[model samples]
Target chain A: MSPLSTLTPRTLKKPSPARSRLRGGARYAPTLATVGLFLAMFAVGAGMYPSFLSGQVFLNLFIDNTFLIVLAVGMTFVILTGGIDLSVGAVVALSMMVSATLLQQGWNAGAVIVLVLLIGGGLGLLMGLIIQYFDIQPFIVTLAGMFLARGLCYVISLDSIPVTEGFFTGMAQAQIPLSGDLFVSPGVLLALGIVAIAFFVLHHTRFGRTVYAIGGNEHSAMLMGLPVKSTKILVYALSGLCSAVAGILFSFYSLSGYSLAAQGMELDAIAAVVIGGTLLTGGTGYVLGSVVGVLVLGIVQTFIAYDGTLSSWWTKIVIGGLLLVFILLQRLFARKAG
Target chain B: MKSLLKHRLAWPVIALAALLLLNQIFRPDFLGLRMQDGHLYGSLIDIMRNGAPTILIALGMTLVIATRGIDLSVGAVVAIAGAASCAYIAASPDPGSPVTAATAVLIAVVAGLALGVWNGFLVSTIGVQPIIATLVLMTAGRGVAQLITGGQIISVSNDHYKSIGAGYLFTLPISILITAAVFALAAVLTRRTALGTLIEAVGINPVASRLAGLRARNIIWIVYIFSAVCAAIAGLMISSNVTAADANNAGLYIEMDAILAVVIGGTSLAGGRYTLVGTVVGAFIIQTLTTTVYTLGIPPEVTLVFKALVVITVCLLQAPKARNLLNRLKAAPKPAAKEAAKEKVAI
Candidate 1:
């Protein structure tokens, strides 16, 4: 029997509450915990600030975190396959730089968008191919890719490029009114659309299942005749595509491209994925959970901001603490499952 | 000679020599050194001085990576150590006193030890993956440093403290002497005793080693603490050099450079065998590369690309697949003869 199959109990036995809890809620415990935390934090915020409970305040959370949401969605796929893509942040910066530079040069906005997406996808594909063919560790390969992409960004320009194109600015300003004093921007809508597609693809597609299988056990997946190589590469490609879209959203939000933009964003995305109940070890997670994770992060930042006296650096410390807690929680569930 | 050529240190040593040669070609006086008022003065000395921090960190990283683990928080630890030390000294009534410097160093060392213990607990006791475990501190450490400094850069004007980084000892940079002493101590401790074998055994097969009565957890824990201490000292060197603790930029990306140094020195990230000498060479190579970049008139912003390119080249050269391919090519020209020779040797 394969090592993976050996992980499952072969003998029939009576189930205890602990065992049943391990079998049932273990997979969802982290997500459930995340939801509970978010709600509790929200309650605290609402209690602390009367204005924090408004529809506009919540809408602003989605709008502000749209870029992170999109990035996390892509990161979810990579993490699901037991791989990591540290190049996402660098790719985002590269895309922003490329898009801003092109738009500043009077290039068509549509063409620039397509080109940026292609660049991101191409870079991911290259890194994926290197990882697949050369059998290099994903961490090291992605680290190299991160360096390369960041270097390329500097090669393009060291200074921030302000995007003045009408299409870009208009997209930034475009908003859809929902209720009284509440509205959503195009970036938020795009983020939601990406999340929906990611959810559908992850849940309903053969490729997505293959990705999960690969993460669960690459050797077993290969023995089972899954398209491990292609799926692995495609997972990175999809992540790259998502990063590109997120980069465009970021540009639309900020209307400028700075080389220093999105520094440490990959860590943020990883934190969100972990917080949302997705296992960093891979195999069991949901894209939607990652969305919740992003929201949790956004809410924490919002709370800190609302406090009015806390330093912005507190957000990092809080997030780091949350990441540690969630990781320990995941470890507990994993131990119980085993 | 053939066996010597096959040694792992051969490549890094050769790479370092090649870089020095390149420097020499670019500037004939690159190798020139002179004594001025009892201290050596030259570009070579500068490389040794500047490379000291990296060498110290890489020495610790070598052991961590050898144990099938990594410490991503070392860079952050550097910041924390620097922040703590500098904060102490800056607040001291007499910052220039040796007592203040010694006390500050003690604070930094204690802070590093605490952080290392925390990391060790998370990885060994809690069974957290080393990367994620250290990453927690890596993320929060800078914030802690910022808090220590109250979100401001604290600069010190302590002559004694500055000498730790920039002072000369026996015509050598004090930083270089400190790094060498640490390296020699590590080399003796690991090699003279059974500790090296135990570390290797734990790295190669923890389960088997544990069953064989080795304290894998203790070994892992000690290595992390050692790494953190190394990072702390390196942090002191860095902050002392500049006489300022800018939490935001202190030790920024030094982890990457240290990791690269370890890998370039022929230490596999997968963990197993390691070489301290190779790590030292690797550190020098990296420092030399940075110096070379500036000497070549490359813009500071574009220098990272050059560094990346060189790292990629070195990594590709060291990869197992590339090595196998090269061996195959070497044998292909006389496959029949090579086969006969192999058969004879086997018989």
Candidate 2:
């Protein structure tokens, strides 16, 4: 269906295989830049802090950032479809709140998890329907979704609910030893598993290609007979499902469900995705780049923690600066390619 | 009457009146006005006074949105402005003096202007998407604000400064007066000159506008700067009203509220057309809705749910797809109704 139709070169002439490889490499420029930056920062930390070189410290980054990685994976899907989901952070909180309340009510832990995930996905589906059917702007629709989810959280409980369920607390305390000294939490493993699945789904699936096609040019994708509507809707639903998983991980990490938990966490997930090299305009990025982005963020925080003198606000400044640089690089690359 | 009904602002104005009526039904004395010591007092006045900040911000937002851009950093700008001014006031030799108050206001406005310039540069010069460009400041601005205030809640007992927010002038809140003045200025600047047309041109089609000899970048720059300055002025009012600058909480989610107000006022988010009058009415409607919740004894926290409902409903009503669906439904129902006409006519 496709082999003969693609014979016409996009440019003046078809590129040689090496030239194609070079062009492909250039497309990964932002992700590569992020990877390089992460390494440089790691080197700086290694030179400054003796403990930073420890293998456990590297594992700890995954442990502490488990929820973020999961959320960024979800965000990667939404951004890949040329949409943004501002409701992810709020949905995460809503999931946590529901889970904590249900647990306190003596509901089965597994049942609670499934129900909260469904709730998250349902809310996302509703937003997606509204956004797609009504043709409303994604940001405005997601913004309302954010308000609704956060409001529902307050309605559930204004106070933080401690998740003392036997299953939850047990999972929270459980750790898997990878070697003599290296260990990771159950949540870390769950997050990593999700990332692996996401990497495969995004790269190997037709849905993944459709997402990129839509992002590149939605009208053209529609004309090409792609299931644009359902894909767009499903992307948001996928993001919501991921957010619910992150919420569970977040609750495990903190061992409580606060109404205000994960406030602006969507921004963190987006920042990671952006810094990892996904263009905010959508399409042309890797899930692995996002993982590197999360690692970079974790290292920056660790560096500040080691310094001890810098205030917590420095984290915000550094992240903001990094976002600016990565976005500018993307702009430059886009200019050159276009 | 028909002309009045056809006016662009009719719906928002009617919505505002309906909200007031609803509040009156909840509280019998809701709409009552009283005068004491030559000053007027009423819920109506309170709505205007309390909504001044939102109204001011929404006016600038109208322009920015018209240029097909958004300023997410406005809320952050609010925090920085209040933090800067309050810190300066608290450090002044005479914190309560009028001169000190004037200096504080000037400093805050200047800070806002500078922030606007940064936003404008990022969008216009660096060519960052407006949402992402402003987002950089949105994330970092609070950090800057906390830095200015040294991470403390700065409070000043300055009467002159307080007057800007809480005090009255000619029986009306000074804040209301300030808002009215700014609204007038924006209206004149846009309507009296070619700025409004140029803005709409850029917003409608930047490339075409550029080809047609319009300075799209300058228009984008101006709107962003205007938005930032408006947010700063609103920040001053908020801080001056309470005589305190709480960096963390001041203007939190205000950008959302301002954007909502702008949208509800009949301005399309897609940009091109805007209504300043409608925006003011929208802000007033929002303020009344909040007050109405309090009067009905609904926990104000649930107001977010109500806001979400309102924004979605408004957007849906504005959406062309919704209308298309409505037409399809109508088309489906018409034949069935026509077929039943004989039976109905016999009845």
Question: Model 2: DockQ against the native?
Answer: 0.75
**Per-residue error (Å), model 2, residue B176:** 0.8
lDDT of 1 by residue, A27-135 (tens): 8888899989988988888998999988888888899989899999999999999999988998999999999999988999999999999988888888788778777
Which residue segments of model 1 deviate by more than 4 Å?
A1-22, B338-347
Candidate number with greatest DockQ = 2
Q: CA lDDT, every prediction?
A: 0.90, 0.90
Superpose all Cα atoms of candidate 2 onto the true structure and report the RMSD in Å to 1 decimal. Answer: 3.6
TM-score of chain A of 1: 0.94
| TM-score for chain B of each model, two decimals | 0.97, 0.93
Off by over 4 Å in 2: A5-16, B1-6, B327-347
Q: What tens-digit string does per-residue lDDT give for candidate 1 at B18-39?
A: 9899999999999999999999
**A294: Cα error in model 2, Å:** 1.5
CAPRI verdict (incorrect, acceptable, medium, high) for model 2 = medium
Candidate 2 lDDT over A2-119, as tens digits, reads 6754785667345567787877988988999998998898888889888788889889899999999999999998998889999999999999999999999999999999998899
